[model samples]
Target: MLWYVLVAIVAILVGVVIGFFIARRYMMNYLKQNPPINEQMLRTMMMQMGQKPSQKKINQMMAQMNKQMK
Candidate 1:
């Protein structure tokens, strides 16, 4: 009976680890295929805020955003 209980606990732990990895991979892939933001969206947002966004500034912002994600 003790052996059976130990095996059940081990199985449950392994399953949880595997599930975590699988879910993480899925989300990473999804994010890569569909990023949370794009240059056009960023430009629109800056315009709405009454700021004239230059290409260099936009690129800098994008770099900062990507760095934050990592």
Candidate 2:
């Protein structure tokens, strides 16, 4: 009975180690296939070429647009 218990414990440990390696490999492969986007790069690019408005300026512009629309 004691030998059986030890064998079972060893099998479980081996399974857990195998699972960890498999999960790591899968995650690495997924990231390699579909890399994450860098939003900051997009933001920086737009800033270099497009209009950059501030909160107060945007508010003022909105007020002016409302008056003009009316």
Prediction-by-prediction clash tally: 0, 0
**Best of the candidates, lDDT:** 1
lDDT of 2 by residue, 22-62 (tens): 99999878865654433444445446878574556555655
| Model 1 residue 52 CA deviation in Å | 0.8
lDDT scores in order? 0.94, 0.68
TM-score between model 1 and native: 0.87
How well does candidate 2 score on lDDT at residue 33? 65
Superposed Cα deviation of residue 67, candidate 2 (Å): 52
Worst 10 residues of 1 by lDDT: 61-70
lDDT: worst 10-residue window of model 2: 35-44
Candidate 1 residue-wise lDDT, 13-62, digit = tens? 99999999999999988887888999999999999999999999999999
